[model samples]
Target chain A: MSAKMSAATYPLSGPAKVEINEVAPRDGLQIEPFIVPTEGKVAFVNALARCGFARIEATSFTSARAIPALADAEAVMHQVERVAGVGLTVLVPNLRGLERALSCRPDEVNLVMSSSETHNRANLRMTREQSQAQLLAMIAEAGKAGVPVNVSLSTVFGCPFEGDVSEAEVMRLAKAFADAGAAGITLCDTTGMAYPNQVAALCETFQRALPKTGLTIHLHNTRGMGLANAIAAWQTGVTRFDAAAGGLGGCPYAPGASGNVSTEELVHMFASMGVDTGVELGALLDVVAGVSDLVQRDVSSQLLRAGPRLRTHQPPAWMEEFFAKA
Target chain B: MSAKMSAATYPLSGPAKVEINEVAPRDGLQIEPFIVPTEGKVAFVNALARCGFARIEATSFTSARAIPALADAEAVMHQVERVAGVGLTVLVPNLRGLERALSCRPDEVNLVMSSSETHNRANLRMTREQSQAQLLAMIAEAGKAGVPVNVSLSTVFGCPFEGDVSEAEVMRLAKAFADAGAAGITLCDTTGMAYPNQVAALCETFQRALPKTGLTIHLHNTRGMGLANAIAAWQTGVTRFDAAAGGLGGCPYAPGASGNVSTEELVHMFASMGVDTGVELGALLDVVAGVSDLVQRDVSSQLLRAGPRLRTHQPPAWMEEFFAKA
Candidate 1:
């Protein structure tokens, strides 16, 4: 018998402490067609906040004409009560958006800058370098204003126009964010083009290049690898993650790109592995259901529909009994 | 900086030789509602044989009335062009099934015994011990007939009636199968109850107890852990896997448990990790489409819907014109 197989508990040679950032209210609601009512957004945020998520992306302060779904960002933010330990965050596109977000006084402001030049122009109407500099200036401004900044390095995974993104380019953007006093950096697989090998390699490189900055991963399951990429990032010691309730959010520009990583699914994956993410499974499901209701569409979360994998218990009937009995 | 983060490639510190057992002909077809023509089965098996699969579960020698899906097993086996290195296998239910399988002269025979006592009684009208003894007898008979035998421990993950299964009970069944001279043991998530943690724990236990015995995993994505469980098993040195092309096969008892782990998705997962499993991606997709035609339903495989995530080359129209002119 192999000596490694003799151990009772499979010891993974990696760090613990995984943190999931709920992006449903922001990323999820942004793409939905029918506007989720301000009250529904508040209820959704509050419900997810109770799930022990340390950070939740609450809303996006963008042009009302652009992302009409989240136009009532301030009203939603005002109505939702933040949990004690949870950080309520809102996305800010520029200094004006950041100023509007500061009025809501969210715990953190997420500033997004596309890594690809074409994506930057499409998403923000700025060059990649100009957007990076703008993001850095915003981070400096946020730091002075006592708001932690999480810079989302979008299109780092791949871009719609630019087929293959270089590792050096991603590292360069990550270093820029790190040097700008950004509280954390998130690599958004905006186009869902990352393979596991690429994710592992780039995450390792990013971690080494910016050791002090906290790294978060935002993945899309468009190609059915959201969970796999999350595992790869987890193996590389990335703690923070961006996921949507019921796997919401798809890129409008990227054809066939699907939803973000399902939050219920992510929680289920980590909690089953004996890693503590401090999220309640049942509560998270309630949030998924609420969000699904708010959006008026079938959310693409397998766990939400199929239920958790329990070794013993007949589901459907058993689930009704379990919940009723509870 | 963490030492693990600086390296380009972390050497996966366990077993590397991956064994993929193609069960498309048997497990893939057995659950289909439509009857696949005998020649179609033969052609499918021959195509899979050329894919360098180490073991191919070809047919199940059972009463046509019991499983009408595999009624033409004998004719399919008689027509398939046997490859030199691949092991052609069939499933045997009882002594009569074993007799029929031996007549076809398969390279190996697989006997399925459920760990759930209720499932054991439901699947085979005998008690757990009686089934074990009958399997032992079949193993003895197969050894005399000069054919190898493999055992699939079904419902090892969970049972509908029994809700949760214990690691100890599964290990006991594996020991019995190994002691009976079965060439290998397959852990089946019959009801999709095996999560990745349980998979890791059981695989580590199986590898330790049966060092020389082959270990294979047959998973259904009923609860969405199919891919995650595969990765967990891979990390624990489990190489052999069973997947259906286009994610076909489901249990009649477990309603909504329709998809198996898609062969194309598994191929993508392994290939992306730089693990070579000699199935050609393009050819596999073609076979999936062919089988989908034979079965008359779109089997759920995302990669079949979305092509491989290779880098796209999007040259500017002017650049393209310039190159075209040149």
Candidate 2:
């Protein structure tokens, strides 16, 4: 696309490149109405790995009854061809989920619980303390198994059923995750409540408080602020973010719609701003096409319709003639 | 919904409230396939005024042949109930459009031109200077007629037909507008080509250059960056933004689909971030619903379906029971 440059150009402020965690196979598809076959899921993930994605959240090991869409999570986890550097993450809600996830030998396990007292009970069917205690046990198991662990704390910004969340509580949860040996901590907006200022403020605080821990912000476009929040986070010194292929929300079945902040959109934004994503964007589009085929519907990608920003077209006849004369 | 507060309560690092100029009447309807009757257009403008939008770009006075959707612009302008505080702006291309628009007594006239030479030629059928010189003359005419004038410079960020735009070129155009007795200046993304950093950078530059001029960032979400760019501009101290009720683009004889940033979505984002937007979120939703009906399809709005971030639902039975036990 003519609208974007290959790179931002040498020099200038901002990180040299930002890392994107592709969560479409896991997060995007988890809530999809139809379950994509595990073979297709594996092929899809393997394709994403070749696109130079440093990390891919391949699947979630929740109950088959709870999330039948990801019922073959173990198969997808085992079948996706692991690349040399790409990290494969599977969402493990409880110890049982972690144990099932471990049997398939995932590169990393994502332990999730909401920060809100009410949401944790609703989503995980356990109190915050109970979930945390169990996650600590899972972390101990994961550490021994030589697999790193991360925690996704939902409602860190706001909750759907709850009105607002306190920054103090969020900080406490992040601190707990750091103390519990989480390889990284992800601040999940849960319902797209994040704004740029809040993102900047939280990232600033997290960097100061947990200097050793890597920080990731998972955002939803439910309110259409995903890319905006991502840019703010990136500008505020955050380097890792979770995004879906079509920006599909985690969906009603999973959490929310993984959201439609389509990964293509983020890649386009970073590339245009000269921020390196280390992704073959053209190849990724093919992957998106494959995804659209599997979903049997259009994915929430704007670039697919508009082409790249740099894309140009000949002016219409009247305009061309008028300009030609002038 | 309970997800949004009536107004932002606490002080924020950025401007407490941002000004939103509803552009659906002109920008949104222009691209629409069918020409709405004058009474519907009048009612639409009247309703937007009641929703607390201080400025509404009511209609464009382009030739009927050029843009049939707004052919009855004069009738709509004269028929709409005039709200005292609302500034109703009409887009006028040259002296002829300006003259016809003056007969209808618009509050403001917006003269638009593209910054890139190729786009300027294709879109306006004139050299950049020719368009600017004519706009200066129109400004003089509007000044004599006691109508304030503003200029909308398109492709200030990037052009689909051309490539990237020069900041120098954009600054020069702004300066010309300043010297032409224009009351305000709007930097339009045209085809959704703006990036947040570039938006922040350009607004900062323009502010330094034209301290007295009122600046507005008119963005399109074509690339899904409309809200992102708008937030960046607001944080950088550019308070005013132009948005459509349903993220409609400037379509010509289309039912409606422009991809401009949705006004309701922006209001929700600002409110959620504790930034006040004088517009009532609930009343604006009514407007979005109305627009969706007029377009005969769901408009490109997310919150219209998702409701506000503070919106709450009863906890699921399982979660309620789990929490009750605790």
Best by DockQ: 2
User: Per-residue alpha-carbon lDDT of model 1 for B1-326, expressed as tens digits?
Assistant: 01122122353323334667877788879988888889888888888777777778898998999899898888988899989988898999999999998999899999988887877765665678988999999999999998988999988887766767788899998998898788889999876767666787788888889988989999887666677678767777787899877777776655345567777777776765667677777788778777767887766567766666663535343544543454
Give the per-residue lDDT digits (tens) of candidate 2, residues A1-326. 01333334221134657788999888878777878888889898999999998799999999999999999987887788989889898999877888898899888899888899888877777888998888889889898888999998988888777778888999998898789788899999887877777777787778889988888888888778888888777766677878887676554623343374688888888887778888888988888877777766777467677766777656555776676676
The C-alpha local distance difference test score for the whole of candidate 2 amounts to 0.80
lDDT per residue for candidate 2 within B74-148, as digits (tens), equals: 889878888988889999998999989999998889999988887787678788989989998998999999998
Best by lDDT: 2
TM-score of each: 0.90, 0.93
Clashing pairs in 1: A311-B163, A311-B164, A312-B163, A312-B164, A313-B163
- Give TM-score values for chain A, per-prediction: 0.91, 0.92
Query: How much DockQ does model 2 earn?
Result: 0.45
DockQ, per model, reads 0.33, 0.45
What's the TM for chain B in candidate 2? 0.92
Docking class of 2: acceptable
Off by over 4 Å in 1: A1-9, A13-16, A160-164, A311-326, B1-17, B311-326
- Residue-pair clashes per prediction, in order, are 5, 34
